[model samples]
Target: MKYTRILTVGALMASLAACSAGPAGKAELCESFDQLGTQLLSGNGIGNPLFRAADSLGDVAERYSAQNLGSDAKSLHAIADSDGTDSNELRNATMNIAKICGHPLGLG
Candidate 1:
């Protein structure tokens, strides 16, 4: 019973710590999403940086949707997945992401 109590207390403390380390703030999340979008849009081809941008956008998309940019985030992912051979798609997606993030990177 004592060990069980100690375990429960430890679990509670861990959960509290996790709760304190919450998600990034709205401005930060939006800026990160915009930055990744810019990188993907500027990429010359489907390379490491492009793939990294896509991967990062996956996380950004989740946070963006939480902040009510669900349609833009989904569109961003779709463009990322489909724009391997066409920068125009990426450019359009970047514009949408920038508009949603309110931090345009001047892709147009």
Candidate 2:
């Protein structure tokens, strides 16, 4: 029984570690930004419900090792979280991260 508990605890810790291991590389971060861009750059942009869920993106950004990446993500997420966030600001924030990730996202 004690061994079982230890194994379970070990498994949980491993899962947590894996979850915390942010993007594998710049490519991964760019992919994440791409998803956000799709939702944000849409006609609805901030009006969309998915835009509200963008706050979790910062958690991933924070886990990234790059210097400006996290801050850029923070700016995007911060603007996203703001009550009066505008589409232009959102576009700019997304562009900043996209530029850093080398995957510039253009709006449709």
Candidate 3:
């Protein structure tokens, strides 16, 4: 499933490379990314933690369209659309976004 998810996201990224507009910068992405990370770590008992995190990522991914970060955004969309994605999938996506933003998030 992990490999499948990566392959799927990779395909989406290839398509997103054509975009030239993205978020103002990675800092903008980290703002939303950090908030979602906080929520995920809080164990606040949100019904769909992965989806919530993914939704936040999708919003940031829009800004990175030119950088081919759409995979993160698209993966987030897939997660938000369904409630069955495993934590590993979301975790990988989170890590990828964090690396791009140069922010190390505590996503316990």
Candidate 4:
């Protein structure tokens, strides 16, 4: 009986871990967006590259949302593609998504 109880508890813990294992939540997405925006605002140039990279991140976030990966697609995309100057911010944000979603980008 004790062994059975232990096994059940172990199973429950495993299930909970599995449930919690994937993706950033909406709050995290919002925070990342804000950080990216701040970076963009502090940089220079036309800002088109930043926006383009952000758009790509937004696309991935939307796909994740469709798969129920814990982000709000509309909100994340809106925040991500918002105005900014820092190219790194956009790149980092997209890279973060790629890391989380297990999608790697290759530069040709």
Q: For residues 21-92, what per-residue lDDT tens digits would candidate 4 score against the true structure?
A: 556455554444454455455543464544554554464455443244334344435544575424443444
- Residue 38 error, candidate 4, Å: 16
Candidate 1 residues 1-108, lDDT tens each?
999999999999999977744664566566666666567566645365764665456456556534555555566566556635345555555565566556554332
TM-score of each candidate structure, all chains considered together: 0.49, 0.60, 0.59, 0.31
Backbone clash count for every predicted candidate, in the order shown? 0, 0, 2, 3
Error of 2 at 75 (Å): 1.6
Candidate 4 wrongly placed segments (more than 4 Å): 1-47, 65-72, 85-108
Task: Please give the CA lDDT of all the candidate structures.
Answer: 0.59, 0.62, 0.68, 0.49
Per-residue lDDT tens digits for candidate 3, residues 7-66, read 999988877864534454666677777776676666536576746776866877777644
The TM-score ranking, best first, is 2, 3, 1, 4
- Top model number, lDDT: 3
lDDT at 10, model 4:
100
Better of 1 and 3 by lDDT: 3
Q: Which stretches of candidate 3 lie over 4 Å from their true place?
A: 1-22, 44-50, 103-108
Residue pairs with clashing backbones, model 2: none
| Candidate 1 TM-score versus the reference | 0.49
Error of 1 at 58 (Å): 3.5
Query: In model 4, what lDDT does residue 25 have?
Result: 59
